[model samples]
Target: MSSSSSHPDLILTNARITSMSSSPLPSNSDAIAVTHGRVSSIGPTSAIATLAGPSTKRIDARGRSVVPGLVDAHNHGVKACLARLYACSFTFSASPQDIEAALEGFFERNSGVECVMGGRYGSEFFKTYAGQLLPTPREWLDARSRGRAVYLREESGHNGWANSRALELVGITRESVDPKGGRIGRTDAGELTGVLIEDADVQARLRWPDWTAAQYEDAVREYVKVANGFGIVGSTDADANEGILKALSEVDREGGLSLHVVAAQTTPYGHREEPLDYGLHERWRELYTSDHVDASFVKIYLDGVARDDSRTAFLLEQYLPDPRFPESHRSHAHVPAETLARDYVELDRRGFTVKTHCCGDGSVRATLDAIQAAREANPARSEIELLRHEVAHCMLVSASDIPRFRRLNAVAELSPYLWSGESCVSHRRACLGSERVERWYPVKELLDAGTELAAGSDWPAAVASVNPWPGLASLVTRTDTSDPSSAPIGLDQAVSIEDALRIFTVQGARAIKRGKDTGSIEVGKSADFVVLDRDVMEVDPRMVGATKVDVTVFEGRIVYEREGAN
Candidate 1:
């Protein structure tokens, strides 16, 4: 054990370190010394003792796994903030009635509630709503609200459930036509189903309620507090819209935000010309670089998911169950890819970075296309910083496109939480077939191909278990639903525990184009790291995901320390 010295800068001693700069396995006995928010030394515990000074602050690992603080890589900062305002218990809901009752009860107990928020009702739980596959209707919530607007988002965050009054306020009704790449679920007689799914639907609703900057700031503060408690040192925001960016600026001004914010703005469909004035990218940079915010880049969704064909996921060959819809043949190359490729080229030219939401084959193709175009457009810039460009979810990437990802130095942001019940269905079987399904989430293949990858919570957009452990476990075990114990899906495709941890840490930094700044415990790097309760390497792979955070250190600051840790 390294004795505490009179050092005040920052020293972490007696630690089992997992420096992603090296192999994923924990280094036997490493000590990390950080000063001025940068790692000053990382080596044997004995060596670090030499760097200790009278004013240095020391943190003894007490023999725990020490790795870079987990980076979300891809997520929605605003939603993370807003989600805390509504009923949020999702891991417990077993039935639709149970969910409705719980929500209704929450409403009843918390009278004078201003608005109903949150967007995590799984498909299995919503099946019985109104005795059909639909969203929780506005009618259901009308009784609970005394004109208080109740707004609930669907699991995707792309959709939502609003009260009748809320609907009337938005002026949405049965005759509403579906927006491009979005759906408004309807009843048998074509009546408004109250469920909005995808970009278009949400855009339609956005036209209705305009949130105030003060309210949004409050939401962001609440979210940041929760994150700090859970040991999250930073998050790579996927949706940094103008309004949300402004609110963050306010938080930064007040010095209320403590976590590192990698702000990535989304380019809404309707407002396409890339925002000539104060665009998401420009504003984020201006605000982030000024203080607490970290404007790393932007977010663009090329397509939808594997299950939903109506949106944008590229169809590989043909529609699985339905033969009439032509296979998007997206992986090979197409639109968003073509458009994105062009856009990326311009962005790269402008010294901007990016992370695109590419779920299906088509989406991935579009993302890759954008990267290629960007590189070609500016050939002279030689070493175009890969900028940690990421393909959000390579759910069904074509075999041919895998190599391109590596060549471009782009990252694949894997979301194993997709293993949840919502993803397991007859459609998956009928559309992808068991064999195809088995190959999904190709973690090993991408690793073998030499593609840098990162992990993300996609929080508020995904499940309740956003903690990196569940994600780490899911990546290693390839299990979410369908009894992973009996047999894991794509077992061969899964990576080792160490690799998974890296994907969530150092690799995540790379994805956000911040590899040079945070990510590892090396000297000159930010003191952003987490202390685990147990040695993650010695634990069983299955148990890894269930691990807890003992302490989270961000920029030499102890943001979260487990209750037991003194």
Candidate 2:
């Protein structure tokens, strides 16, 4: 072996490395060298040792496994951090009594604050009435709100339960009309129930107290620490408003960011009449573009969740009969087909990647249609083909549309956190029927169709933690890693461990538009990888979720090291 002209900055040896590269290395290769934040050399330990100078740092992996740093294709980075740090938090499976107890404790701790925000009771909580009933959601929240304006987001983040003070503050009176593409729950007499769905929830949340810049900065810092600890080197912030973007930009500017964040600026959801602020996206791109922050992405919600109580997801078939509405009702798209196609074409032309939230088969089809329109509209532009627009949350895609994903060069951004047979899945089955529920996720079929699959945690929305192991495990086993006794929802949809890893790594980076720079451990790419506590490939499929990150390295720098780890 010969040494290079310049010495390396860091080296790792005596470990199993999954490079995820197209080219295969020697069978005996087990070392990597990094210089100037990029992989400089990769070969056997003895060969790479010759490239190291006196100042180069050497790490002995001691027979651990190393893989490319994970990427989360869809996440609300700032919102998740804020909720973890300040909100009255509860699990998606928490009971009404549990939620009330959480709220009471939060209120007592922040006695002087006028507004309180927390959430995430399961969607089933709204329909089951498992606890004492009040006249309406407003009364139910009022009893536990301590006279403070309270707004608790539902598990799916598409609905909310607000106290009277919150409703009054947000100006939802008896005469208030439901916003287009959303609903305001009401009693038979047309009185407000303090249940806001779809755009109505957006309205209340926008009107709620805004956090200060300092608060946002703190949240951004905390988010980086949490994400890096979980082996995430990069993520796409699913919804980034001005506040979130500014915080991310400032952090990256100050050289405090350890994660690459592709900010998907928020666009109007469920409002077909509203125009997308293309100018706003361009302006943010110019102002917030930094070393680690890319602001050229945008997020759109084509429809809401598919759960029965909400009945907001745009479905191809009619939902099961419910007392709340007409028997023939199948939810509709937020934007008309023509409008969606037009917007998508323009966004695609402008070099912006769009991620549309599609929870139902109908919405999935509509999104694919729009992408097809964009491709046809700009047949000559190579950039159009490169834009890889995404259908976020492909919870239920019609069997026919599966091939369109690969044909349109689109990405299926799957949230593994929701794939398990959890309570929320049961709620979806109640409205969606057994046949539709049985086909949930369809991971293997998408892969077989040559569709690029990207994995995301959707943290703090449906899932409580950012840990990817459990979700990774669920991808292969189709069962909740947390509960061994739980049944698998769609066992046939399970993918292999190798496919699951690729989805979380290279595919995720591709979804965020950073595939060329990161996502793999090949030479000349960024030195971003994680040392695992165990070899996930050798572990029992059911125990994959129990895997942990012992050390996370980003751009050749060790960012997170577990305490007492070898």
Candidate 3:
């Protein structure tokens, strides 16, 4: 350890420090010194006390546990934050009647709004309404929309439903054809349905009424506060647009956001069929070149989620066909492996990191192949190791591909929020059958193979809130978190509490290639840590989710202090 400077900016005393680096639990250290927003020294309280000076501020942690601040590797920052104030949400248990009631309630309040952007509708909406393949008639949505253009995103964020008015407003008629990597939902008779899938969903989102810069700023301000409260020090905005980047830049200038944010440019949404040329690349540069946003990554969707209206996630085994609507049970890769490999290579060659959404085994395999192709095509690029490009939403991976993640130097980002539960598990069972369902996530299998495992909440897209505690709990328990009486699913895949914590902390940072600076509490690292109400390491595995963050420190400054917290 480096010798501590006599004059430190701050001193934390009487605390249990879990560096999440050298120790699996809180180390024997009782004090730490911070200088210039980075850890200077950590050891016994008496040793650290010698570094304090007249100007140094000292805080007593009251025996609370301090650990590294959590990092979310795969998050939809803008969309998740905006959903808090701007959208209506539904849960997996919601029936057709429930959806109508929720929409009606929204319309009653915003009576004169021209466009409505609602979300959180579950994947089973069409299945429960008319069966699978068939779309709910536009008039059913029009009744609640009150003639206003309405577009509601499915819970998976891979598909959406629009009212007839919205379809007309966006110029989506019978003559409209599906764009590359996108699907326009249509009936067997060739009639335009109100459902939009893949790239089409992205296009519909682009057509929504744009929010003003000020509005974006407000939403982001609240979002940062919420994230701070949860002990999140950094997040990767996996899906970012020009407006989202601009808002972040504004927030940074105003000194509102204390959390570190890395933004990625989203692939093709506004226009159809454009050549991948220098002009397109320059547009990405122009959009995210702000001081606050790291625009060095590209986000691509290789396939849509299997749940909901768009069962487009590419799978090696065919899904069980719905007895009534046999055509509904199928899968397709939104971006073919060859097409994705070409783009992945170009982006990697240009020094851009890549993050793709791959929810199914086929998509995951294809993504791995694409990354390997990129590496082989650019064998001389030594920086490939530094570019830890990841594939998010790896919910299903073929056992044969488990070892490939480490071989390809790719991170396996899992959404623990959907780890194990009746609603989510039942959905998988219905689609993939009982035998395949047993191997849902294979978290332990990946970890045991020396593959880096990263956990993400997937935020507003998930059924639960964006709190990391529940996700961590689910990772270790692999059972129904809401009900204590619920049985465990895939008990063999459950990881230890320490493993779960590492996945949420250091492993997450490694996924984003930011481990050296901020992930752990060590000398020369950023002093981003959180104090908890209780020692989570000592708690019952099931109760870990109940542990609350009492205080959050970012860059040696206390950013969030819970009411009456020590």
Candidate 4:
């Protein structure tokens, strides 16, 4: 390696560097040297002082906070987590009348749109509109479309409401068949309720419309810029459809993206098959053929949200306290244990990393079983290091199975920020009593069990704040958004600030098998880190979320630096 004086790249000094390397919980150093985008050296200010030459671009951290760049093990990059920024949003606020008024204005702005796409909804906020008790559905959508066609998805992508005209465009009617894995909401009179769930005509629409790779590349650039502004350096582009691989590749070839993404190849099920569709198993193998442009991994959703009564998540016992009512409702299995095992074996055998979205104890257990079978079929180097897979939204895990995760070396890609507050409150409060809610988010439990844990926003679906500190705060405080007055989600299971930070950084990298690469500050590791405005640990644990990232780095390059701060 060339000496810093002769071939200086950059050197960050005076930082209270918190390296998550094997050194210790906290590092014994205050400065770090960066050359050729990897850490060149790290030691006390006096020790590595000789490495910084006059040619090096030095920065005075002035005791500012520095931590590993965040690596979100789970997130959706199919579109900007919030699909369309400029799209006319009819209802964004949390009230019915407010949504109606917003829709009125939206109609006026986007005069030519034939349908109101999804994103106009506050689930429980409803008022009578055209004989429908949908809060986000307003008369303006009906009036503007003039019965032409309008399809709008609920805020929760799980459900959608389409106007009569839009429904007609897709041949949807009361007489139309209900496809497998989807539901059409109806009234007692047997009239279609305009609400659709689980599945959609979206698959049909995608097949019908074909956009050039050029168009998609532009959208992706803006998407990354927007997310970077919010301090996201890494994320799992969960379950991207078949052709998306090519589209993302086009963008990469043109040098258009600044973000480091892992575009998860969609595990196409009965969802849809294309003309050139080589099918799920084959498509997966092709997707990862070249880990070009930094894209990585494959994503699969084993079940739906735990809050949905009809979601079919596998649960240990059906009679667990219902978060919607005092009595527990019978839980059902959506995907069988054997089937999941088969899929994992096929996917793992093909050399693709798998990340499954599982909630409730039953789903998690079933997933574990599948993973176990895969290991048995093809013995891994080590159970814990074998797959490096993760289970997302592990809302409720059985105590007995917690240790199994550590034994297997799997990670729990969790989202307390989603399950912690209001969304947790409005839907789950009534079903699960305070006692059950007390242990709702079991972060501490998983840590105790030796299972590695990572953090996620599950954006658009959960609508939780996107900042990592807020995620860390939620993990420790156990407080929900609606009632900040209450303690954090699982205070009993809460982790220290340092540990929570690990979940977002080094530990997160470990979840994806990137521990030796970018998670921590090491001599040969990429220069990826975040400069915080406030000291995370010293600040009130509750105020951790308020800590803003002043600068962000990825791949030994300075990707983001705040405007005014040093």
Best by TM-score: 2
Model 2 RMSD to the real structure?
2.7
lDDT of 4 by residue, 386-407 (tens): 6666777787788888888887
Instruction: Give lDDT per model, in order.
Output: 0.68, 0.87, 0.77, 0.64
* Global lDDT of model 2: 0.87
Q: Which rank order by lDDT, best down to worst?
A: 2, 3, 1, 4
Candidate 2 lDDT by residue in tens digits, 393-507: 8989999999999999999999888755377777887888878877888999999999988988888677878888888888999888888897887789999999999999988
Per-residue lDDT over 1-566 for candidate 1, one digit per residue giving the tens place of the 0 to 100 score: 35454343788888888777763333444788776667766777787877888777778887878877877766675666565654434432435555556666766777766655544665434544556433346555566556776666655555666667666667677777776556676676776656666654666556655567777888788867677665676677777776777777788788777677777765654324332222546656766553657665777666665554333456565545455345443222224334556678767766677777766666677678778777667777655354657788777778899899888877888877666554443335556668767888788999999999987777766566456677777788887632445357778998888788778777877666667777777767788888888777888777776677888888887778788765
> Is 2 or 3 the stronger prediction by TM-score?
2
Q: Tens digits of per-residue lDDT for model 3 on 454-499? A: 8877776754566888788888898757678867778898999889
Task: Please report the TM-score between candidate 1 and the true structure.
Answer: 0.86
TM-score of each: 0.86, 0.95, 0.88, 0.86
lDDT of 1: 0.68
Score candidate 4 by TM-score against the native: 0.86
Better candidate number, 2 or 4, judged by lDDT: 2
lDDT score for candidate 4 against the true structure: 0.64
